[model samples]
Target: MTESTPALPQRPWRQRYHVAAIGWTLLLAVLLVLSSLMTGANFGTFLSNIDQFLALLVQMSHPAWSYLHVILQPLYETIQMAVLGTTIGAVLAVPFALLAASNLVGNRLLRGLIRFFLDLVRTLPDLLLAAIFVAIFGIGSTAGVITLAIFSFGMVSKLFYEVIETIDMGPLEALKSVGATKVTIIWYAVLPQILNQFVSYFLYTLEINVRASTVLGYLGAGGIGVYLQRSLGEFNYSATAVIILATLVVVLVIDGISNHLRRVLL
Candidate 1:
């Protein structure tokens, strides 16, 4: 009793609400509300029109099973476009990747320029590429192929260079000490370590291109998406459902294969 401690003062209710998380949450909610208003998003109108949306959903649920045959050829074409495009882009990416790698390229100027060019390429949207190519190539798999090739190139080059830069400098140093040429060093010291990773990345990019190829066709680039656009224009929701389901199946299969290969390689 001779050394009794004083009671601690409690924070006020207003102070309790002064946490960083609460402040951030309130700010985010306010921003969302303002954005919605500015964008003409009327939730009340959406709620009122829910019945029509439900009806459309009900129509899509019952897919046209017999329409699967109609899509098979175009679906195969889509796969072909994806495969061709990914392969072309991957091949083109190798030299660019070698040039861009910091460990491989001694010239900072060259590396920086390559990186800047890559950044510019990567910034171009896939849709815009598709549209431009369609205008040039006149609506066929040619447009689709070129668009995918460019898209894949921009993506895969960056991935490859990053992989190259992370490789053990030990092999490179040893080769350089022995007076090995650049090509020999790259072939003997560089390729072996990064090959698996490169393949893994190629497979991943291929998976993305497969999906992108379909979308490109919607803009007259020639794939299953052409049929998809047609179906939507005709208001044939059942056919659209079938097309979507088929695309999902193909994507799932590719994903499964890609995952299995990655596991084995990695």
Candidate 2:
């Protein structure tokens, strides 16, 4: 009909960026394939062997309800361990978190040292910690409790210090201007502002500790994991199913409580 409208030319920078993104994506895909090959991970093999997994699932479909009575004591022990460990760790983390907070601690060197210590603590995986504690404290719930406490301390301290760093400085400054002591300023200015966040994080840590305590039991730390290990070893899928269902119920209950508390605090 009329003269055709000319297409707008793409920007050189835009075209280069697009090409770079595509290149990176292709490289990533190639790396993934290479890594899978190196690890002997074959999707085709998994697809072919999937029926074995289905059979296992069928075995677990019917839970042994009577197993609940036997596990009640161990489950109670697990909950108690989580509560005690969380309390101990959370209480201990306050001073360490304050020391680690860059905003609170004016000395960069001191903050760095505290953070380094925290990093060192965090480097030890939970399973490794449990094993170490089990060796030191002997095989019992005591080792599990100690492991949970250390794990919670490392995690909660990091979370708390980050929260401290993000707090509004205005109240802190105001408190300082009134010649308030460090502890007083923290109690009045900082803690109030971050109290809700602290509770939320503490609850989150408690929930995690519950799951972790179960695993610690495998190393003779004492919990439901011992039973889980035994069930798998004995090929008792029915008992394993009951244990899994009970743990799921406990997790769901904790989650519900955590959600409710978070909503109230928020």
All candidates: TM-score? 0.89, 0.88
Give lDDT tens digits, candidate 1, residues 1-266: 49768878989876887777788999999999999989999889999999999988999999999999999999999999999999999999999999999988889999999999999999998889999999999999999999999999999999999999899999989999999999999999999999999999999999999989878888999899999999999999999999999999999999999999999999
Task: Flag clash pairs in model 2.
Answer: none
Q: Which lDDT value does model 2 have at 159?
A: 98
Task: State the displacement of the C-alpha of residue 147, model 2, in Å, after optimal TM-score superposition.
Answer: 1.5
Estimate candidate 1's alpha-carbon lDDT, on a 0 to 1 scale: 0.94
Question: Can you write out model 2's per-residue Cα lDDT over 156-191, one digit (the tens) per residue?
Answer: 999999999999999999999999999899999999
Q: Which residue pairs come into collision in candidate 1?
A: none
Best by lDDT: 1
Q: How many residue pairs clash (N, CA or C atoms closer than 3 angstroms) in each of the candidate models, in the order given?
A: 0, 0
